[model samples]
Target: MVHSPLKLDTPQEWDLSDLYTDFDDPRLVEDLDSLQQTANQFRQQYQGKVKQLTPEQIVTCLQDLEQIYQKSGYLYAYPSLVFAADTRNTEAKQFLDKVMEALTGVDNQLLFFDLELKSLDSEAFSQLQASPALKNYQHHLIRIAELRPYKLSEEVEQTRNRDSLTGRQAFIQLRSVHLGEQEYPDVTTPEGKTANTEAELSALLYHPQEEVRHNAYSAVRTVIKEHNLLYGYILNAIAQDHKIENQMRGYPSTLQKQLIEDQVSEPVFTAIMEGTASRFDLFQRYYQLKSQEIGQKIRICDLYAPWTTQATPPLSYQSGVELLLAALEKFDINYARRAEEFFLKSWIDAKVRPGKRGGAFCAYSHGKHSYLLLSYTEDYNSVFTLAHEMGHALHFAWIDETQSYLNSNPPMVLAEIASTFNELLLLDSLLESAADETIRKSLLTRQLEDQLNLLFRQSTISRLELAVHQRASEGSFDHLFINEKWMELYQLLCGDSVELLADHQYDWARIGHIFFKPFYCYQYTASNIVSLACYQKYRQVGKAFIPGYLELLASGGSQDQVQALRQYVDVDLEDPATIRGALDYVEGLISQLETLI
Candidate 1:
C-alpha cells in the first residue's frame, strides 16, 4: 500500500541570491534609479529626434534600452515568482503589487518612444537599418511598425496601459481573491478519509483503486458545481473582455490579436489546428487499447488513471535531480549540465506542501534566473514534469544570456517546443531503459496518453474555443452553449472507448488556460508538431541541428517565431507535408506499440 508523505515536511527554499541580495537590497534601488534616469534622458534625446537620429544612435538606444529592461525584468520576476509560490502570504503580495505599480509608472513614460519610432518615414527607417546591429532588429522594428495601423494617439495609448494596470489588472486581482482563494471543500476519499486540500485531493485520484478515482472525481466536481456561478462569471467576463479588445484592435478573429503578438500568421495556425485534429485516430485508438488494458471500457473520466506498477518509490530530492539529469544527458550534455545547475543552485521550489499552488511552471526572470514551482510528486509523471518545466527554464536561460530584454521570451506558442521536446526525450529514454515488457508497455501507454492530451485533446478544445468566439462575434455566445459544445467534442473523441460520465461534462472548468488566454490551446498542438518535426531533423541531421536550434533560441523575440523557426529549422507550419510528417511519426510509434502490446 502507498503512503502519503507526512505534513510539515520542509520544502527546500530556493536561493534568492541569484536575483538580488534581498527584495529591498540597495542594488535594486540603485538599478531602478539608474534605469529611470537613462530612460528619462533617452526620451529627451530621442523623443522628437528619433527620425533624425543616426543609425549608430538608434543602435545605441536599442542596446541601452535592452540592458535596462533586462535588469528591471530580473528585478520584477524574482518577487513575482516568490509571491506565486505562497499566494496566501500577505507581505509578499503587497510588496510585489507595490513594486509592480512603481515599475509600471516609470515604464509607462517610455511607451511613446517606440510608437513614435514606428511612425518614422520609410526612408529614414531604412537608413537606420544600415548598421548590422540595427539590421538585426529590422523584423522587430517591423512588428512595432505593424501596430501603426491600429495606433491611437500617444495620450490614449498611455492612458490605456496605465488604466489597464489599475482597472483591469486590479479587477483581476480582486477576482483572484474570490476565485483563487475559495476554500474548496475537503475531498472525501473512498476510504472515508478527507484530503486536506485540492492538491492532495488531485494526488489521491492517481490511487490505483477505481473507487478512489471515482470518489475524488465526484468530490472535486461537487465543489466546482457548488461554485459554478462564480467561476462562470469570471470565465465569461474575461472572454468578453478579450472579444471587445480584439474588436477595437481590428483583429480579424478573436485569436488574431494573440497571433499577432505571437508573430505568426493565421494560415499557419489553421494548419496546426487542421493537422492536429486530423490525427484524432491516434488518440482514440490509444484510449481504446488503454481501456482494454485497464479491464474496463475507457471513458473521458478514465484518461488519467494510474498504471498498476510499483507504487511511487520514495524518491529523495537528490535522486529526482540525478534521474532528470541522467535522462536529459541523452538529449545533450550541455542541457544535462544546465539541468543539474538548476537543481544544485536551488532554482526549483518542489516542496509538495499545503497552500502552495498546484501543478508546475517555469517562471522566466529574464537575466536573473528562472524559478520552477511544483507540488512535486515522486512518481514517474513528476519526473517527466520536472524535465518539462526545466526545458522552459533552460530555454529562457539560454535566451537570457544571449538576447536583449525585449527579446528574451518567444511567443507562448513556440515557448512550449523546448518543454515538450524535453518530455519526449525523457519518455524515450525511460522507454528504452525499462526492465521488462509490461513496464515498457506501461511507459509507452503513458507517453501515448500525454500526446493524446497535448495534441488531440487540446486541439479539440481549441477548435471549440474558436467556435465559441465566432458565435460570440455573432452575439449568440452563452456559457451553456460553450459547455454543451465542449461535451460534444469530448464525446466525438472518446465515443465508445470510455463512458462519458456526467461530471466529466464540466471538464472545461478545470482548464484555466482557456479562461485566462483566448485561443492559447492551439499552441500545445503547434509546439508538439514543431517539436516532432524538429526532433526528426535532429535525429537525421546529427550535431548540425544543435547549432541552429541554439540560434533559434538565441534569436528570441528579435525575430518572429515563424521566421526564427524557419531560418533555423526550416519547418513550415503552413505546409501540409510538415503536419503529415508529424502525424505519420505518431502513427509509426503507435504501430510499434501495437506490436509490443
Candidate 2:
C-alpha cells in the first residue's frame, strides 16, 4: 500500500527502544550519575596533575572521560533529536533545554582542563605518558599542544567560553523559530493537483513541466517572504556576533579562524575555492545543455528541475535498504553489514509523520548507538539520503569504537569525507547496474547535483559569506548591504541564466550555518574536492586504499586536515591539482551527460 506524505503539523513519535527503553529507567539515571561521578573524580585527581600524571593515568583518564562523555551524549542526544524532529513536543523541549543548561555548567568547569594540559612542557608530558596507555595517544597529545597558540588566559577564556551560549547559541536558537513552522498552501502541479507542504513542493520541483517547477519555487518563496523581517534579524545578529569574535581572536582574514579550527591553512582554503571558481565555464556549459534539454530558457530554480522525462521508479523501504547495503558492500563487507544492522534494529525512523524533522541527519549518541532522522518520501533522493546518512553513522560508530568519546567527532572537514565518499561509491555502483540509457543519464544527473551543491553552491555561498562578513565589519552591517552581496554571489556563480529578484535578495537570512558555524559553508567545497581525490585513489588501488581511509578515520581529532590528507591522498591542499582534480571530475561528468543528450 502506498503511504501519504507525513502530516508535519502534528508530532509523530519514534520508538526510542532502540537506544533506551525509557528515559527514567534506572540505567538512564544510573548512567548519568556514573558519568558525573567519573568526570568529577577525573577532574579532582588529574586537574592539576595532567602534565605530571603518569602515561597510564593519562590513558585511564582519557578512557574514563570518553566513556562518561558518551553516556552524557546519549543523555543529551535522545531528547535533542526528539525536539528537533518535532518542535511542538513540550516535554522534549523542556528536557532538552534543561540538559543544555546542565551541559553548559559542566562545560564551564572543564574548560580549563585542555588549556592547562597544553601548557605542560614536552619532556614532562612525554615522561608521564611513559605508561603504555599514553603511547597510543601521542598523536592526540601533539594535537592538544598545537592549540596552545590559540588558548587564552584562564579567566578570559572561561568568560569567553561561558558567554558564547548567551550570544551565538541564543541567536541560533531564535533563528530556529523561522524554520519547523513555515506553513504553505498546497502546491499545484500541471494537472491542477496539489501536494501539501514544502517537502512535497520540493519533490514537485523536479517535475518535467516547467510550469510546475516555476510554481513550486514561487510558492516556497511566498512562504519565506512572510517571515523576512525576523529572518533578517537572525542573520544580522549571528553575523555581527561572528565579526566581534573573529576580531577578538586576532584572526588575520575573515575566514582564518574557521580554517585554523578546521586544521587547514588559508592557502589551502583559497586553492580549493579559487580553483573551483575558475572552472565556472564547465558548470555554465552543463546548465546551458540542461536548458536545451528542457527546450526552454532555464533559471536558477530550473537548475534542480528534473532533467529526465521518465519518472524515477520508487523503491520500497526494504528494497531501498538492500540497495544501500549492496552499494556499500562494494567498499567493504563490514560497511554493508553495519548498514543492514541499522535497518533490522530500527536504528532508522523511516515512517513519514507530522512534526518530524523534514531533513535527514545521523545522530551518534556519544557511544556505539547511532540514530538516523529522515522523513522518508520513498523517492530516489530519499534512498541516496539514507546511504549518505548511514555513511555518517558508520563513520561515527567506527571512530567511537576506536577513539575516546572526546575524540570521536572529527573536525567538520573530515566529517564530510566519509559521507561524500559513500555517495561517490553509491553513484559508481548505481551506474554499473543501470538497465537502460535513461536510468544511466538520471544517475549521471544526480551525480552532477552533488557536484553542484557541494562544489558550486557551497563555494558561491562561501564567497558570499566572506563578502558579508567583510562588509559587516566595515560598518556596512545592514539588510540592504547583505542583499546586495548575496545577489552579487548568486549572479557570479549561477551565471547569466539565473536572476536574483528583490524579494529573493534576503536568501542569506534563511541559511542556518551563518548563524551557527561561522564560515562553515566552505568546508563542503573543501571536503568535496578531498573526497573526489580520495575516492579516485580508492578506485585506482582497491583494498590498498582501505588502510589510509581507516587510518584517517581512526585519527579523528588527533591530526589536522592537511596532515590527514597528506597521509591518505598524498596531495597538498595548497597545490592547484588538489582542487583542479575534483573540478575536472565534475567536468568529466558534464561531458558524459553531454554525450548522453
Q: What is the TM-score of each candidate against the true structure?
A: 0.90, 0.90
lDDT of each: 0.72, 0.72
Which lDDT tens digits does candidate 2 get at residues 1-597? Answer: 112222233212356674567556677567666666766766677677666666666677777666666667777887777777676677876777776766665655566577777777777766654556676676667667666666776777767766766776777876664466666667776566676565666667677777777777777777777777677666777777777776766766557777766677777777777787888777778778888887767775677777776666656666666667778887888767776777656677766654555567888875567788776665677678878888788888778677766566688888878888888888888888888888788888988987978887888878878887776677646666677877877777768655445556765666667767777888888888888888988999898898789778766765566777798667566678878888889888888777877
**What's the lDDT of the predicted structure labeled candidate 1?**
0.72
Candidate 2: residue pairs that collide = 7-354, 8-355, 55-128, 55-129
Question: Model 1 over residues 1-597: C-alpha lDDT tens digits?
Answer: 112122324436667778776666888678777777877887777677777677777778888777767777776776677676776767667867876776776677677678777787877666655567677677767777777666666777667677766665665554544444545556564456567555666766666677667766776677666666555556666666666666776777677777777766788888877777666777778778767666877555467776563444445555556666777776778877777777667778887655565567888777576888877655667777888899898888888777767666688767998898888777777777777876687677677777777778888888788877777677645456766887898777776776887776566777756665777887888888888888889878877898888777777777777767889998877677877887888788788877865
- RMSD vs true structure, all candidates: 3.9, 4.0
State how far residue 582 of model 1 sits from its true place (Å): 2.1
Name the regions of candidate 2 deviating beyond 4 angstroms: 1-14, 22-42, 46-52, 121-133, 190-193, 501-503, 569-574
What ranges in model 1 sit over 4 Å off? 1-11, 21-38, 130-133, 174-176, 185-195, 307-314, 475-478
